[model samples]
Target chain A: MPNLYQEVIFWALFAITVFSALLVVGQRDMFRSALALIVTFLAIAGIFAQMNAEFLAVAQVLIYVGAVSVLVIFAVMFTKDMPHSTRSTNLQPVSIVVVGLLFIALSWAIFQSQWNEMPAELPVFVESTLVDSSSQLGTAIIRDYVMAFETVGVLLLAAVVGALALVRDK
Target chain B: MLERYLLLSVILFCIGLYGALSRRNIIAVLICTELMLNGVNVALVAFSRYSTPAFMRLTSVDASDSVKVLDGQAFAIFVVVVAAAEVALGLALVIALIRSRNTTDVTEINLMGN
Candidate 1:
């Protein structure tokens, strides 16, 4: 049986995730949407915490909510008069019905999958060696997935340089 | 419990997809993308917990073991890092587009001829 605290946390995170996601889609103001997106990120981080991936929870907060959301908001601030053009074109009834049908089909497929039958048990956690997570992660990136890690770094560098070039005035 | 979480993930994903496909504003589309990413994160962590031994047999698995918990945690870390990179690139592109077009509407960016 799950603990009361865990259950509560799950529900809270679930509510936040779903509600903020809805806000992201439904809100007219782009800034509001961005703010809702931050809430959604936080809720997801909380889900990570529930999953016993504490490092991921912290990273989610630090990287996604802290960095990505801010970058998007900054871009929004620099580019547009967001308040003036808050309202987007409405979706047609036919499109909404189609999307609704698609959602149902997808949900049904997910429901039918046998997720629990092939349970690969999680490894044990050692409290004394909790500090090794970052190191282990670093080692994994350097040893096993070094190429992919380096490629991601290069991609980031390219993005930065490309942004500068794109934003530069002729 | 897994059903509820999965349902929430699906809802969030669809909302994001709708925003991405339907919205004309570029910033709105970006926000939608972030929402989609968050939805994916929720599902990943949820699956990790649902399958983890600690979570499955809560009374038996000690709370202190960290190595056992690294797989999902590591994947989440990588996802976060990639997301950061994606946002940086995406925002840069948006900035560039805004500078060139003087507008952020998808409908308005018709410079690429067919």
Candidate 2:
């Protein structure tokens, strides 16, 4: 079981994540909403750290908070002059109902399911050096998941070329 | 503890859904989609920390006596990679839209209509 401090931190990060996500959705100013999105990503990274996924937490920071948020902010800046409002559309009522129903059904299923939970902490090794999760992840990617890894790289290259093609001068 | 995390994921997903469905700004819709993806990552990591598959439980073999599958974390990484690509293309598309339509309002840019 997680200690009291961990529990407190978890809840705090959770609250921050939810609040920032709401701001991202509700804020009228697009740039400020983008800023709030950075906060949400940061909080999610913190959550990942709490879950013992230190490698993923770092990746989340580097990729999401760093690259993705910057891209979004730039996009917002580029389109700053575009006439747009953040107000809800005519389907707002229907969307709210659908979202609410989705929440209820998902929560119910989560509660009803029986999960085979692992022990809270894995047994520590008696060896000289403790295994590093990041190193393990690197090995896993380059070894077992090499094919998928290369595919993602190719996909990223394709996306870059596609984006340039779409936006370049005609 | 796991349930709490899953609940948070559900809440985030729902909020994103509502925003994506109702908001007028195309950028906001993309941001909502990112929020939804983040929610999924939370659930994936939570499950990773909390559970191991039945096959890898007590019969694991290693120095640490743990099965280091890390499947959930791997999948989450892929999700992030795909999301980055998606956001890049999406932003590029947004830029293209702005260049052509001079607008970011999704409702106003109806190029295909009867």
TM-score of chain B of each: 0.79, 0.87
Q: lDDT tens string, model 2, B40-107?
A: 98898788667654445455556432324566777899999999999999999998988887888888
- Residues B4-114, candidate 1: write the lDDT tens digits: 667877888788877877787887887777777777776675664564434435656544333444545556556667777777777878877766667787766777854
- Candidate 1 chain A weakest lDDT stretch, 10 residues: A117-126
TM-score of chain A of each: 0.80, 0.92
What are the per-residue Cα lDDT tens digits for candidate 1 across A1-170? 66899899889888888888888888877778888888988888888767656677788888888888888888867865632455554553544666688789879987997766214332334332334555655554566566777787887788778767766788
Give the runs in model 2 whose Cα sits over 4 Å from its true position: A121-131, B57-68
Clashing pairs in 2: none
DockQ of each: 0.40, 0.68
Error of 1 at A100 (Å): 2.1
TM-score of each: 0.81, 0.93
Q: Which pairs clash inside model 1?
A: A122-B53, A123-B68, A125-B64, A125-B65, A125-B66, A126-B64, A126-B65, A126-B66, A127-B64
Count of backbone collisions in candidate 1? 9
